[model samples]
Target: MVLKESLLELLKIKAIANITIKELCERADINRSTFYSHYSDQYELLTSIEDEVLDELQNTLQLYNHSDKNETFEMLQRIFEYMASKKDICQMLLSDYGGRNFQNRVMSITHQYIIQKWEDEQNILKSHSEYVTLFVLSGSIEVVKSWLSNGMEDSPEAMARWINDFTSNGLSCIPKNENSRLK
Candidate 1:
């Protein structure tokens, strides 16, 4: 925790470009070797933080699936709610805001969640499925960006309804063949 806090504080000072493992260890009062024992490098530490945040987000999403009737809308609500709770971490992650890499990360995670739920868990989505996953990924990124820019004043349930209604005719409910017809 000390080492993590030390690194986070340093990140606050400047972009990761200016920080060094030596300084991180010094601030944490941990041995340089101890830092190595825990994390391979500074990049590893950053990636670990991202993983930790993503795990929390995924866990919250899982809770929405516990009841069959409450999955989709609840999942959207949970996403905004959970992201609101981790606002600082998100602010750190999105500092560059909407960069290609960040967009890719969000899309990849959303796709993974959909695949895991509709395909792997229930064995429903086709083995060759790419169309729906891509649609959901693109749509979700756009939706999230809008919510973030708006300050997200809407309640999670209302956000969920917005997502549900938008997606109703947008992607999830549409057949893959219909998707091909669009483009």
Candidate 2:
């Protein structure tokens, strides 16, 4: 916990690329031995923090069982609320100072979530499901990145509704079987 707290504080003042193990240990009031006992290096420590964030996001998502539109929107709201609660971490990860790896990891996780949701919906796609999923995921992530970069000024519920509207509306354009219900 100290290491994570220290790293986040340091990230506020310096980019991840600029932070060093010695500096992190000092800020954390711990010795190098203690630092290395937990992590091989600074990058690994940062990655652990990212993993923690991802785990929390996943936990928030696991609360939902159904794939209905209302449930999906509720899930999105919880995700945004979680992110808003951890704005410091989210902001740091999304910032230009934050390495691309963190952002990519976030996007990858989100894409996986969307893919799972789409699968649950059992909707038909004109193209490969992977392509359609990627299209929706990537576009949604861009909108979220912009929201984060802009300080997440909008309420999480408001942002979630907007994202839900955008994604569901776009997905409606995909051709489907006449017998299938729109997800």
Candidate 3:
């Protein structure tokens, strides 16, 4: 655990690119042998940390996946609450300093979930489902990243409410007949 703790602490102040295994071992007060026992390199240690966080997030989201339609909003609220509880780590992983791979992984997780939800529904986005999925996933992730960047100024419930509202009403806000004009 010392290695993970040390890596996280180092990540807070420095980008992963600048972090070396020797530095991590020094900060962790562990010898190179001990570090090598756990991870072969700095990148391996960093990835292990990322895998743990993603696993936790996936588990949390899975808990709400089977809920009833009426509980959708509540599920969203709980998801935000879960993220809030892990704000420090989430902020670090979602930060600009966080590698593009990590950010893309987060989006991929969300995108897959949305796709599953759509599959479970009777009336799904029959038209351009791929684009719609990306639109929704990207929009949601951006909002979350912005919230985390602001140090999560709003309560999780409040942020969830805002997000849910936007998602629920966003379609109606778009001009329904815009396609006709293009023709």
Candidate 4:
């Protein structure tokens, strides 16, 4: 636990590729042998942390039937709530220092579930589903990153609603003046 937390702290400032085992051990107040005994290297420790968060996220997604729109929103709310609960780590892991690997892994996990839901519930054409899924997931990830970066002033429910609304209605979900030129 100490080592993991220490690594997370280091990740906030530097990428895992740049973090050394000695620095990590010093951060955790442990010796190099102690860290080596549990993990092979910094990457292994980082992977361990990512795996833990991913496991919990996968379990959270499995708790609801996402095929239904309403259920999907609820599931998203729960996911945001989970992210809120782990704000520190989530923020760091999603930051530039966290690397594309973790983000790609997250996308992979959600992509499977979301694409399945879209195919089953909306009957989106198979040819277009991948593009649609990638667009939605990429935007959703940026939204979550923004929410976290902004200190998450909005409630998870509210964030979830915004995401769901955008996903379902696109730009139409935003209101505009009657005289607005763009229609």
Highest-scoring model, TM-score: 4
Task: Estimate, for each residue in 28-118, the C-alpha lDDT of model 3 and write its tens digit.
Answer: 8989998888789887887887888788767766766522443656767887887898887777777655577677887788667666676
User: Each model's C-alpha lDDT?
Assistant: 0.67, 0.79, 0.75, 0.90
Candidate 4 clash pair list: none
lDDT leader:
4
lDDT of 3: 0.75
Candidate 2 per-residue C-alpha lDDT over 36-148 given as tens digits, one digit per residue, 9 for 90 to 100: 99999888998998888889877876777435678878988988888888888887776766678877886677666666666667775635667876776677667777888
lDDT by residue (tens digit), candidate 4, 4-86 = 99999998889988999999999999999989999999888888889988999899888888777798799899989999999
Rank the candidate models, highest TM-score first: 4, 3, 2, 1
What is the per-residue lDDT of model 1 for residues 114-161, given as tens digits with 9 covering 90 to 100?
766666655665764467677766776666656665776777677677
Candidate 1 error regions (>4 Å): 9-18, 26-31, 63-69, 97-106, 115-129, 171-183
- Per-candidate clashes come to 0, 0, 0, 0
lDDT (0-100) at residue 140 of candidate 1? 65
Q: How close is candidate 2 to the true structure, as a TM-score?
A: 0.79
- Which pairs in model 1 have colliding backbones? none
